[model samples]
Target: MRRLAALVSLLLLPLLLPTPAQAAATPLQVYGAWHCGDDACIWGNVRSTTDFDAKNHWLIDRGDGRPSVNVVVLSFVHPVKLLHKTTDAQTLDGVPRGMTADIVNYFAGRGIRVMLSIGGITYTTAWNSALAENAAQFGRNAAEVAQRLGVGIEIDYEENSKPDLVGLQAFIDAYRSVLPYDPSGANPAARLTIDLAAGDRWLIDIGRKATADWLRTDTPVLDYANAMVPARQPSSSDAIANWQEHLDGKPTYSPPIPPLAPAKFTGAFYIAEGNKVRAECADFTASLQKSTGSFVQTAAPKGAGLTPGMLGYMFWAAERPSTKGVTTTPPNSCEGGVGGGATAYAIPIPMPALRQS
Candidate 1:
């Protein structure tokens, strides 16, 4: 009789203890920014450390000793050029002259993770040509670049109307063949990821496919996805709405998109809008990063994994995102907004281990 009572207590104890998700919710693991290089999304020339530091002091030192972001994604390697292994005065061994080891070390030395983004909107056609020509080779080339640079890679293929999902898959498969996924995140090249549109509306086909396959918690093919900022900076409420769409996918579509795991993606916000320094770069209090932060940290899972809360925030385009936009230099720095966010969230200097599911 006593033995039976003890067994009953033991079973109840298991239920009494908090589940893994309930024990301690995952903190923001990726507080990142996309750097557009010196030439507005194109690294045109090799820059001396002195000159580079002068323009990017704000990123390295956010008015305090700590950096404003934990990760910096160097925006855009032309897919066609990378595929053809093109080399020119501005490019060396298929990589931009400016995306040299020095620039990577500049951020890495400060305990920040660096990644290289491939195929922006400008390279949409290039992506098609490369994928059609030889997606497997393109993937292999991208892997080579990642291995050489000691950085991660992001696939930003924005083919909205009609996407080449088959070719894209081939590319992903080839890349993974060279460098398999590393949940431990010890291997930088293993940290492969993709970019989705702001919401389920724009990149419908791609979003559906990614959510259904790649972004799954049980069998995650990619590290995560970055929901790129919309055409413009949205209000806090509007931003939440957009992010929520990802959490609860559009089930009514022709081929429904299953819900995405919270741990598998990050929501993006505009640091600056065109030439105007938005609140995300100028004032944390008025920023969407502030207003929608609670949702980002505690939003419940809708139809995917059991865990709550999304990964973290990603700011669009550091430095000059566009030819006419404000340069994130000196007086127009992001110290107040992006920097304040770091402090508020206590973002880990060296990004902590990300949640798998």
Candidate 2:
């Protein structure tokens, strides 16, 4: 029986090989971190002191006609937080202000669609309280915010404490209610996305379940799920190994057709320890190609993982490279105590057709 099983697996290998078209198929989404508006504005955070004007931020490069990078997912739009500071709550119900709208227009003018990440690590605290108490309201609030921003929302709920799948479902249900079904159609307003952590244990539990739910087209929670800062596995081969491991597991829920086709390979900080990052990037790309039969951008090596598949790629704050921490000493007493230069290098691959928005 074991030999027969091996024989069956061998026979299926040819059929499993991705065709050239599949190998070259562009990812569903890709690009840089979109940080605009007051919250994400360089002036708003401790990490940055450099104020990013709309024209000068890291959305794209200035030189040459061709974009050094492609596809930009704009990070942010508060969930349940109303826009405009005032006692009046209704005005606050959507995006904080027209800044999100303005940013979207700027990117859209250049044919780029920004994904509005609803919650970050900090923002999850609010969700922790809101979700269990008011799931439906949470969704409604998200939809309103996305509507006002004129962008899709990426739910970046990285709170390990709040691994409540039920809460996540509620948020998704609420957001989906407000978004248009056809993202590519005319005036197709707002998209729903989620940013998942890629920690080994975390991915096995929270990441896998959340992604499985989103991948299920039938599940009304999310249209997209962005795996954030994917950590490297035990070895280079672990890239594909990790993905297969997730696929093999049983999720609490899922769609008939899984959301991911080529899968995602998003990691941040491409310039750590000099040339080390580049080597890791090479291994990451090779592994995905070998295991999944997909081509990925040659990410510079300081980080873990590769950029493969339709769900393009993303980094953390867009301003990190141009700000205070660009070349600063390590705050904590950890190995490699201090660092210099940009923590990440730019991956200038173009991703024009990845996302509908």
Candidate 3:
């Protein structure tokens, strides 16, 4: 009887242990900021388009194979205009200035998810009045951009000194209103997500309050929230600690902030850590998960090398190497160059479709 039980236990152990291939093929959303620049004229490989090309090329190599890294989100930046009412938007003709359909198509063909991120910390002022004064038009413009790009949308609204939750929600609501239920021509489930500042406790408070009502009513307001981890170690710890504390304690309003319950929700709580540039990402993810047990993805500027347990990454700067800081570029490279040669791994599950009930 003991021998028979041991044989049965051995059979179950293999089934329980997750293999690297299985882990690398889940829904990991890795993103990189891409740019259109004049650098292709020199160093051939160092050209501005190299990073963008290399990204897609990387996918071709990994397609249906044992893709250690899957699901790429390419952020197109540069002379690209996010605003609809601006003179450039009005004057520019033929698919809006700087938006190349060919480039967008290049990514989509590879089964990668490309998102147009509007209003980073640098250009956040664009929303100051747009959100406060006129939210309706903001939505219209955002939808139009999504339509033109044929990709999903993202709002990276990161303002620390003057974080306004009301204004932020207003902008998100406005954008949600205009977007069609199925914006992706190919994937109807694709929708918009907001990258909230992790450092701001006030912002988190407002988001939870808003999400409670939004979730109950089933408004297409917010699909997922990306919590931005600070650049330094202490900052990352503080961000996670405060968020966990808020979720775990206190009852200021109805429907208290939701704790990191793996059973109830699978929302993402991510942080950006230096790749090979710094060895803290693996440890950072481990500590945060220990605290909340939420899904985590390590955010790295474009070239940071891979870390263990990384769901995906968000690289800084659309333009790098040739284009320079026109966009915030990631420093460390797995491929060992500015052209993005670093190879990372993650599970490649198709992005869950957002259902509008």
Best by lDDT: 1
Mind giving the per-residue lDDT tens digits that candidate 2 earns over 1-357? 999999999999999999664334443334445453343331232222133333333343333323323445544445445222222322233444434455556566555555565556656665566666777777776666556656566667777753778877766666667774554423324555566554334534466566455544343244555555444333434444444433334333442222232333343322222212222222333322223323233222112112334344443434332323321112211111101000122333433322321
TM-score of 2: 0.60
Q: Which residues of candidate 3, in runs, are more than 4 Å off?
A: 1-51, 54-81, 84-99, 161-170, 180-190, 199-206, 214-220, 233-332, 335-346, 349-357
Residues 90-147 of candidate 1 have per-residue lDDT tens digits of: 7777788789999999998998999999989998999999999999999999999999
Ten consecutive residues with minimal summed lDDT in candidate 1? 19-28
Best by TM-score: 1
Question: Which runs in model 1 stand beyond 4 Å of their true positions?
Answer: 1-25
C-alpha lDDT (0 to 100) for residue 126 of candidate 3: 55
* Candidate structures ordered by TM-score, highest first: 1, 2, 3
lDDT of 3 by residue, 37-90 (tens): 223211112223455555334333432332212233333221123444443432
TM-score for each of the candidates = 0.92, 0.60, 0.57
Better of 1 and 3 by lDDT: 1
For candidate 3, what is the TM-score?
Answer: 0.57
lDDT of each: 0.88, 0.44, 0.41
